[model samples]
Target: MGRNTRKRRTPLATKAIAASAALALGGGGLIWANFYASAHESNNNAWGNQTKAANAQVATISCPDIGQKLTSVPRQARTEVDGELGNLDRQITDAYQRLMTTRDAQARDASFVQNSILQPLKDRRKAIIDRIKLEINRVGGSAPGSLDTLASCTGTPANQTTAGGQQQQNGGQQQQNGGQQQQNGGQQQGNTGQQQGNGGQAGNGPVAADFVDITKVQPNVAAKPQKSGNASTGVFITRCGVNANKNHNTDNVIVAPGVTNGAHHLHDYVGNQKVNAFSSNQTFLQGGTSCQNKNDLSAYYWPVVRVQDGTQDFDQNADGGGKEGNVGKILTPVQAQIKYVGSPTSKVVAMPQFLRIITGDAKTTTNGLANANAHWSCTGFENKVQLTTQYPICPQGSNVVRTFAFQSCWDGQNIDSANHRTHVAFADANGNCQNGFKAIPQLTMRLVYQVTPPTVQNGVVKNAFAVDGFPEQLHKPATDHDDFISVTTGGLANKIANCINNGQRCA
Candidate 1:
């Protein structure tokens, strides 16, 4: 009405022109409007995408106390493009690798013979551990605990105490065998030998965590009594060595707490404070995600500890290429320079001269290079003073363990019958193997003086670290007992004859 009220008709060509003009005006307006609408819609889409990504940057790690749950300690947000995640991840991963090495050694020395079998395994395991630790350290807040660190710290334990006594005894039997794994950690253990390691899990004498001084502790022969007054010696004919078939023999030095069955990498030597660990050697039964099926070795299990005394023939192949062997020999000058920072026990004896071996032993094969990892490598483990702590703290949390133990096996030789050399070691004022006892199995055990009460402290669980090892054993032969009869040319023969004729076994 405002623009076109008249029905104006003119010549036919003129009228067509007017209609075309009107169509052009409406078409132009619609076209311009469409362009504006498209531009506005695109801007909305771009902003939506930006907002979504901002939200995706992180999800809070819930610490209800913090308005935003803290995944980390309130660090800046990281994104795939920024490479922040990878940076944080690398550090944590390195720590995991170091810890793996510590765990591997502890597992290797579960028993005396176990180390021989576990040496190679420990190497491979260390490599794997380094890689794993690297991954773990890179990521923040992994399975936080010391369980893994304490499990793998190797070498002879500082405190290997005895509940009964710390010594091995010989039976009067002629035929004997000695058992020792050179610490390569065997590729495979035969079923027959395996039965004795894991409790009734393996066989008759599962390796307990106790290695005794063969020369120090004597056996009760359990022979027929010759004396008028005396009770029988209780130790005679008790289980000697354990086997996978449940058979035991005193003919061999059974690796204490060796694998009649193995729990592998056991954590919580005392109880409660568990650190993070990585391995398949966790608990087979109920436990956390980190728990693995493994073989466990502890000073508490085998109270007897053996420090290497001397060597006439020690093959580098044995001792995990010095993984368990003492390769450091002080030069005459260097040793003289060592000053006693504190006093050693007056009861302590000096290390016998016979204990030293060739210094360059296992030089090439078992070098620490093979064990280098960011986590707990053997490199960080040493008998030296810590440069940082100035104490003997292993660099990694996995460096030293309170429950760590020494390894030993019976060479199946008679303690009474054979001429054998033995080495002994003990802890001084500080828990260290500085003091050597002048005896075979020439070592003194670090016994625990402080007993830890199993109570939660101040509503916070407190874990105690205690030194553990042997209480020493009686080193005497039976004077008079039924099994202490005089050895006659035919005394042994008569017992055999009686058993055979009676269809019974010898007592």
Candidate 2:
């Protein structure tokens, strides 16, 4: 399951409703309503502010194969990349906290500004970006475009160079709001008043910690390893085909067909050797397998979530241009689950090859309506649901888990639907498949991330996690999608029936 983090502004209509309520209530009641509305609005703003700073610090980094990139990256390479990013994250978090707590520096001279924040921020950011580029290239991927990492800082009060491009000291004279500050040898800094740089710390634009760290409040809950062959429990299994080798390519005709790198997004796929944008049932059955069980060939896939490097190139939405559907870093899933679910009397039936089922909608033009079913939880705190872009930051010993449940009730005929969803419906709360709809094997993916939560300050929650998708989309709990194919041989399907119906645990 993957998604993008976009700030959800209170709709104008919602705001109007709040205002109307305030007017009808009158006086103190109005005060409470207004306060509630303001707090509600602030939550979105806070997330927006934190995300802005976070993305800027990530700077111009390129992740090749953008879709299947993370999973394809070597395990050691991923750990190194995360370490580099985690360090930058910590630095930015510190700088943000400092800027938030520091007094306004409008009265401070450029020299003090340079030493206190600007220089350190620029030097640290440059080093991190350089390191990331080096690491990506080291792993056989192309390095990001060469950039003047400090270009954004050129016009700031500190780091301004002379007309001759020479380092200079200012005359220590106070300049007007839009006037040039005179430098040595008759040079002058530009009249652009305190431009916002890559490092969002300037005279009046001191960076504030937009989110409070919530790690302490929600401690981590460790997962106990599942024992095998308990016989008292039932399990479902999906033997997916080959791991999708490329990121942007797809074979699913329902979503995109014959489109190479056409998703303008990335996705991770398992199952169906011929899986791509144009794949059909015939192609899927002929494809090879990536799964250990060669007899069970099926397709399973979902979007990829990347960690943004400072370049802001991951998604078009992150840059304020919503033309493309998804951009930014694509994160890999932590774990996955596949099983057959039906009534006690029902038995497992092989689903048609290339049968496509998408659970979460990825192409959400709006924020709230998409990702309606995406589920996020702490390993031990499964009941506490997290729905926003700021994914849960699990406490020590616990992991961040994402769960996607696909519809199991198929129409018994159509392998696909126009909307890519209607062909199936979810199993009932009692775990019973719907009437008339045949219960096929249900595939659920549970992805876990081991990440320390951002330090919460002032009671605000800061999210350290970012998902994969269009940055303009909300990435709410609903964007998670899952696809499946049935390659289960007749014998394997019966085995599933015996194991599940008889209440015997088998994996």
Candidate 3:
């Protein structure tokens, strides 16, 4: 059917926050109507004491097995759905607050009229519906409701038609671009405006579209770690601890600013409640963390992983349509180390909060794959040759290990640089602080995937894996990166100094 000929009842556009308003109206109207009908029926009860007991019994008899069937849905799907729903709830809450507080209609309209959340929410809801149906079918039960029967506002304002037409045109252009990519055998890797033909030798290999060429880039080889203090001198404190559990679910404020529902995808965080593009040192310290150390209020975060059967069923782009989530569950690192590495005698002072640094470049999508500092191996294959593969399958009893080591040598000045780098350089191979640069506490993050494998598929072990990165990154393991915030206070800093220098294992 032609685009306009196809039928969909949901309203395409509105001057106000149409979805929220519609949801509110439907919910309130239903409740009020039900209450009124019940009251009227009670009045007609011939027996003045009309069996309130029988009705109560009927209310208590709950539906069977639907909850059980829901459990059958994959955990990754469940988490994705829940995350999206939570995000929508946040949007609705913000919208309601704006509507209640704002006197100006224009301002309210501006906040609500944007289609970013509307379409994405609809897509997620539909996904949930489809997943539920599949689960029900697998369990040999009838679906609770038909997809066509789902309630949604239909009809479009005249202005929306024009916008929709333009969107369709843009989509056509994108399709053409996709065709061009196929003709050239692959997509372009945007690095310093360098264009390597997809078939050219300089291009990244078969999986290059998903990774950066890390082999060629001057990798940030970490300095040999050294302990700073001695226990005999009373400088003993544990500089390392792991933050394993999740603390919050939110969108990336740094890369996809202002788009609350994540124009890209959702991220899971372990520390710093107020993490966003505007989050600062004071903000992080003021917030809390899931870390064992209350004083070590640093933030460690990455994208939630979802396991997939290797299908291109996601957006994989921060600014694209279709599936906007990664294809697999992101296994938490087997060990996440939070410690200081640098010159022990430097006597490091306070580490500032919101000092953001990314260890790997998510933007590079080719020859740059090996250009990252990703170390991947199985439990038993710790010594196995590690390469920059988009995904790694480990042997049975072994999980995939991913580690990220950040630049340690700071200029003794800026917390951040203009390019988000350059202010800090890596320590020398000898573990010595760089010349003219002061040794700062270098934070490191390590993640391990739970793809216990004895199996191999496509000549590689099959594993559930993903990295926290831009969708354009294609979830390539090479694109995996880590973010950190220094929430260390005075006492904690003193302890860290002692632990690293004194060579104590105290936590």
Candidate 4:
């Protein structure tokens, strides 16, 4: 189910110095350690101790993503299927919480994690998967026979402690980018018995190793694809004031239409007023807009980024906030730039109304990195360097930046697919639409935040910031994502197409 074929840029070496001591549970019976070292560590005496501490296990549960495995669910069964999918997510979250809280039991008995936690989780998941199959069959749709096999889950180590300046391969390319290596300086022992102030208030993530100083990273951005003479080179800009209305929610209308708190993380919304899990196509058509142009009522939203400085937001006690391991003071974007550009190979066509598109993978930490699309950088270093796995530490007078370039090719018929991704695709590396798809206006979003750079001192991070995500995901940057639903009228859609095809920049 890997949609995007574009090669990912290699991550810069982290330079932040961090170290965490191993925790001893009850008379030193069981030891769990989560430790990291700086890339610049050259001391022979200290290297041996740090390397042994890094080998201690810090594990989390990993389950198959059921939604990605399904390619077809009947329209009549979609509502029930989506709800069941949300249930699966909730089950995992609950299991992860149990795994974090039951370290004492795990230390006492070797089989505690498997017997008390993972097995029960698998049984619950099997029941849910069976229910999903019945719903699909009830509507006369064929469910995949492999659905039964996806019910079993496994324990996987979460912490990855790499040697300082070690080289890694990405997409068959060798990268040797140099920079100040920032190790995760926070006290992040994933299963360490403590609850608060361990990497984050939720005791999961945003460790110091998750950030890289942007000034030290070498330039690694590739050149843009070349445009032919027939390319639509014009641009269209939309001004939707950056979530000033304070519209925030955890429901995703496109993925889990009828389920509340479906996203499991809070999203900052703009451009549409009437948006919720119950919203329909008609609701979007009749809703007011935040854009200056009244005719454009598109809905644009992304996961809110937060500073983990012990400040609690209103939702800190709610389902998708502190309760789900997403805690901190929410930081509103200083600027949100929404733009539409044309294809490099052909003229663009109008997008269908209510066409739903999602850019990044929300479960990428466990799902692997085939569909991860988030890019992070600083203001002036945008053209020089971009990071996919780590957050950027911007210099003074500069702000943090997040960029998302969505899929630009449409399948020409369905507004959405069962997987919510097969209906649209990214163009090939040469910028041509394949498989009978048509080129549409490419939507790109840029969000800027004025954040005080976090610092690591005495193996603890101060003012640590992270993107909101599922409890198990640990707020990794690769899990950052955005959602959009097109609500343009026919006239406005036609105007946008004409402007791009005629090579005229319009606003």
Candidate 5:
């Protein structure tokens, strides 16, 4: 679809703020409609009334991940197909906004959501899907007939039972469990009449239940695999300053190339300085670097974290910021550690130039946990526990941490894949590359932040922090992700592999 044909809808921030105010003024029927229920909630409901209420609390739209399903997009048609995928995302975002603002209508009629919001959204998606098929067929590639099946989306419930047995409320607040709250995995904590608060300043998410006291979580880190005699046991570290240059944008060049505001959320970038949706392989090769070693021109980026303290940033009214329901002050990480380590089972190979890797799923809240890989913890408790869904409430003097471990196995032939994932895979349990894949140096990133802990009192959260995400994702911690593009010179790539395979550490 052309830009001129796209309908201009009201910004989500404006609608969300207005809806929140209306709900605050005793509009009991109004609710934030995009909240995701916990995955465990479906199996643990015991109360009939609670279950009924949960069913009626239609919170989010769950649709098939078309990008994931297209594992065979032809190279000739990828650009057009990717644009259509981006359009599909925009359609969902608009539909989610309409659902959020029409709580009154939903309360009045049982089928209001299906008839007015979901059906229209499905029709739009079908058109986009058809366009994708046409693009593929034009390039002499066969498109799957099942592509049409992914057009329809269903409403997901709002309330879910946490692993600790506590229930989520219609407004995305944690319902107190008698006088105690359950932590993840059935752990119990005592607290009565405590409401975590409504989702952050945007009124969408990072609810109180989304945060847990890090001290209470048990140690769950797994032991590293033991190295064998022939295993590559070296490490290579890179000093890429934590986005100090303030290179931030909402464009995802690897996924939605040429589409402005393609990501719909702000990303803090380091390394290659001239990257955006329009950037090509040539642009990356010529871009300046943030790494201490100028030879490494790779780009590393992840969503920017924000503090919801009623403060507005430079993009307060912009498409990927407040307008998309990502509000508050953007935070720069206190420290960023980028390291690459050799495979545990075999000698490593140099990565192909321009290899693109995306770790973690940005839509995990709605897509489920198959691709979810967010690791959140506090400084002092690093080895004790890591969280995938909930944000950590760090203790005083202990900073918050976000970690990403990228895929280490490559197919040896393709630098990229249709879904951007099939080209690379994680090593198996035995640390061996599966199929015909080759082991490569694993990239691990650790980012630390100094943030004030948020508190929930009387159903209000103060100074809460959240990861930037798509508007419909509601800034859930589970949706946190990272992206990387390798633009290393052949010599530098060889040096990295030698450093690792030779069992030596280098920077």
Candidate 6:
């Protein structure tokens, strides 16, 4: 055995170990790449695709879902494993379609993102949706699903209740909790039923209103100013709203310059010249919301929701790395997100919020139609809760500039975009700056509540409240008002009865 320090061992053992090491390293890298791509390719953009031009440069979105399984498969086959991920792609489409058609308002809550779609697939869906959105933004455009995905994803999705809620998905096309009549068959409660509680009767409340849909854009592009600068819908508002120390007089404020910053109104924001918010093909997905001090540093007032990264996996079998996009996108699911917790469902709610006139206060103008600058501002909500809307395309050659705050009350604060930030900052500003924050001569709101007769036992009856953590809750003590007043339904007060039972608390 001493023929030169024992017979030489076969080289095969060394080769095997080295090969194994390379294989493991490659596999780990591919997985990491998948996550990397997902993070980097999000569409947290605010400038919607309204202003984009068809001739603009379009970025390609490659979502390849493939992998070199850890079998003894040959490297040649693995390297050439280019195929399709139709199943996964279809899953995403199906989810989006489902989101758009859902009757349950809860499903569209911002926090429901993870609960309904992404987390369930273990990030597969997340990455894909995020990437698709990123791609859309890159091309200065967006897909219909892009809107659907963020439609109700206000918080970030995946709330503490998501997993629980999914498990509690009562077995029925429509769950009958206490034999209540299911009225969600696209029925309009008219103006009366929308504000009044659905206690099986119509009452003399604020009277039912209607949502106005703009069928076409006005050809004229002139700016209009308000007269008195103070108008109100004269409806009741929730407690938190009042407690926020805000002036329900938002309706009273006017966009002095008119359309100065919004989609059609931004002519002043850029002096009639188009300004693009995004200059590259990158995408940004809205991130989960976190509590931030509005009165704190202006820098952190609106931190980006999406955590962006670089590098994309273009290899069919590779994950998030390799190439910039050979691999499929799979962003993570946001947890406990909320769009707008306990938003109102009547025009009266919106009247105090979104509407205003450029002229004198309070006129019963038409909701959505071309008017002769009679009503400078336009907004209507609550009455029938206009869930979703797709705005008209911008005039030719004008791509969407992406507004920071174009949102539905149902959007919650999930987006926390520039449009909203601008408004918030404007409100916080003084004098002239605040003057144009909201359209002037707007209608104001005040909220009122009366307990359902049969549901109450005595004066000590149970009540409803909207709270921070509980989105469906309210400020405290509900009651109607004539003009401007704040109300956050919580604790107890005049509305309470001696008995405790089901109390309808609509925020």
Tell me, by lDDT, which candidate is best. Answer: 4
Q: After superposition, how far is residue 324 of candidate 5 from its true place, in Å?
A: 0.8
Specify the poorest-scoring 10-residue window by lDDT in model 2: 27-36
Model 5: clashing residue pairs?
none
lDDT of 6 by residue, 1-507 (tens): 000111111122122112221222111010000111122333222212211221011111112122111112122321111111223333433343333233133222433433554345435545544554454455554333432243222111111111001110123121111111111112223232222221111111111110112213222222222222221212111222111211111110121111111111011110001112221111111111121211111000110010011112122232111111111111221211111111121121221222111211111110110101111111222221111111111233321111111111222221112111211211111111122232211222212212111111211111111100001101000110111111112222112211111123222
Q: Give the worst 10-residue stretch by lDDT in candidate 4.
A: 19-28
The best candidate in terms of TM-score:
4
lDDT of 6 at 276: 22
Runs in model 5 lying further than 4 Å from the true structure: 1-56, 160-197, 458-460
lDDT of 5 by residue, 270-342 (tens): 8999999999999999999999999999999999999887778999899999888888889999999999998
For candidate 4, what is the lDDT? 0.73
| TM-score of every candidate relative to the true structure | 0.15, 0.49, 0.48, 0.85, 0.83, 0.18
Q: Quote the positional error of residue 261 for candidate 6 in Å.
A: 29
- Give Cα distance to truth, residue 160, candidate 2, Å: 41
Order of models, best lDDT first? 4, 5, 2, 3, 6, 1
The models' CA-based lDDT, in order, is 0.18, 0.39, 0.37, 0.73, 0.73, 0.18
Over 4 Å off in model 4, which ranges?
Answer: 1-57, 160-167, 170-198, 457-459
Worst 10 residues of 1 by lDDT: 475-484
In model 5, the worst 10-residue window by lDDT is: 1-10
Model 2, residue 95: distance off in Å is 35
Of candidate 3, the 10-residue stretch with the lowest lDDT total is 27-36
Writing each residue's lDDT as its tens digit, candidate 2 over 358-384 gives 665543212222223455556776643
